[model samples]
Target: MWIKKFTIRGILVGLVCVFFLSPVCMAELPITSSFGWRVHPITGAWKFHSGLDLGYDYGTPIPAMFDGVVVQAGDFGDGYGNQVMLYHPAMDCYTRYAHMSGVIVDVGASVAQGEIIGYVGATGNATGPHLHLEWIVKGEDGGYVYADPIGLWM
Candidate 1:
């Protein structure tokens, strides 16, 4: 009797968690470049595409793909140039907008989904004006696992 009861209860709980706790993310805009291993445009060598590049004109506004707090926003001076990283607490995931010409949001700023946070630009190690997006899953060691945002879809 105990085993049967626990099995049924466990299944029910698992289903509920899947419905309420995990949410699938959708594409926020048109894609210019997809994610995955591809021949690099600049280097002409096979490399893992870390983010989704959205096509937009120079200075085109880029909206937040989901609700989150702005964790970092500024000229990274890294290869990404001006970027914005948003932390979604509910999902424990981060979304980075890279190669932007300018950022409107600041660190600790709360932004709703679809809110414009920055404009597209070819800053840093970029070829042209486009928003390079990256989705990062928070890891246990206080680090992050870069993921394909398209895989977040339901």
Candidate 2:
């Protein structure tokens, strides 16, 4: 029912907090790496970095940035390690948290903003403990596009 109301207008205004994260959690964390093109930390070649890496202590709790359904959870062996992908219909977008120590939410579960979905870890290709966050929206061609998530989360 909620997906039926989707529109480009929704995506434009979606950053307005249809749901809110815990006030004290993310604002204090430092950004270890930003999104976009850069030299790979693990690899020697240049590649596009799809998400923002938030530096944190190992096993730190990770919260959902918006109210959404957990469309995916667990390690898919795709190099993301233990991850959680949430679909936020209100924003006409999805948010992904990767390289997690553990995933607490399961696929299809509805999560509120600020819900602790997982814990931080140096999983997958990561060199150290951090939370890799991605903001993805649909493109005009109806394909998924990884947008810079810093504007929405911070």
Best candidate, TM-score: 2
**What root-mean-square deviation over C-alphas does model 2 reach?**
6.1
User: Estimated TM-score per prediction?
Assistant: 0.72, 0.80
| Cα lDDT computed for each candidate against the true fold | 0.73, 0.77
Displacement of the residue 91 alpha carbon in candidate 2, Å? 1.4
- Candidate 2, superposed: residue stretches over 4 Å from native: 1-29
For model 1, state the Cα shift of residue 82 in Å. Answer: 0.9
Query: Judged by lDDT, which candidate is best?
Result: 2
C-alpha lDDT of residue 150 in model 2: 64
**Over 4 Å off in model 1, which ranges?**
1-29, 138-143
- Score candidate 2 by lDDT: 0.77
RMSD (Cα, Å) for all candidates, in order, is 10.7, 6.1
